[model samples]
Target: MSLQSSNDGPLDFVKYQNVVDGKLVASSNGETYHNINPSTLETNPEVPLSASDDVDKAVIAAQKAAESWAKVPWDERKKRLMDFADALEAHTEAFSQMLVKGNGRPPLHQKIIYDKLI
Candidate 1:
């Protein structure tokens, strides 16, 4: 099954952006590496290996965000976390499918991840 977006072109399904703070960003060096599946030996060509600079940027962003995000009330944080949990539960099927495709894991195994988060 393909993930289609009307406005955007077809997903490259290759490159994965680095998660900086909470947003995805490209590598500074524009360098990328391939990840091979041990079982099938199928190489995923599009996944960009994040550069070290991305890690530094992500850490800085998280530090900045944490300063403000931590100031919020504990109750509010708990509520938001719970909401996120609920959203994950509601989107279990889609989440599992994405996980299986990216991770090359069986659907049954993906349930373990969701269970662990719960």
Candidate 2:
């Protein structure tokens, strides 16, 4: 099975972007590198080569999220985490497909790890 995205068609499809502050964006310097798929030795998406400015932006965003998350009550945090885990579990097949292509891990192996997480 393949991981298909409504917009991107396939999860492995090309022309990717960097995500910062809850948005998909390009590198500050507009640099990218195509990931060579090991199975087919084919070029994949032009993944962003994040610049120092992007690193700074990402760090700042992460810090803000961490600060807000730290203030949440313990029970609320547990509920949110459990909900996130459930959402991940629901997408196990797509995730397994992605891992198989990206890391060359078998789908079964991916399933096992996801199961353990839940």
Candidate 3:
């Protein structure tokens, strides 16, 4: 899918929404917590927090997917994995920037990502 910019795009932190039990649901308590930026000391609004129950559901769904994913024809799995890798490459630049900003990692980490593209 071609990437399209929407006012709503990156604003949603819970992108996948913590898929649980093959079902998606908002936080049971509708709770959230702030994620502060350490460097700028900026506070981002509380994103929804996934409760333990949600985690269990996610695990069960993953387990179910893995069982089928594992049994998939090996060639098909390899092709799908390659597609995922390509998608990652497409976003590597943004990912590195986000990583540095979020983790305060050394500048070299970005260089490492660039080098990998070689």
The per-residue C-alpha lDDT of model 3 at residue 17 equals 43
Q: Which window of ten consecutive residues has the lowest lDDT sum in model 2?
A: 1-10
lDDT of 1 by residue, 55-94 (tens): 7887898899889889989999899788777766766776
Each candidate: how many clashes? 3, 0, 2
Distance from true position, residue 101, model 1, in Å?
3.9
Candidate 2 — what's its lDDT? 0.73
lDDT of 2 by residue, 28-111 (tens): 998887666576676665788998999999999989988988999999999878877776676677766665666666679868
Answer with 1 or 3, whichever has the higher TM-score: 1
Q: Which stretches of candidate 2 lie over 4 Å from their true place?
A: 1-15
Q: Could you tell me how far off, in angstroms, the CA of residue 88 lies in candidate 1 after the best superposition?
A: 2.1
> Candidate 1 or 2, higher lDDT?
2
> Per-residue alpha-carbon lDDT of model 3 for 39-73, expressed as tens digits?
56666445559888767777788898899889999
lDDT of 1: 0.68
Worst 10 residues of 3 by lDDT: 1-10
User: Alpha carbon lDDT of residue 99, candidate 1?
Assistant: 63
- For lDDT, the strongest prediction is 2
TM-score of 3: 0.68
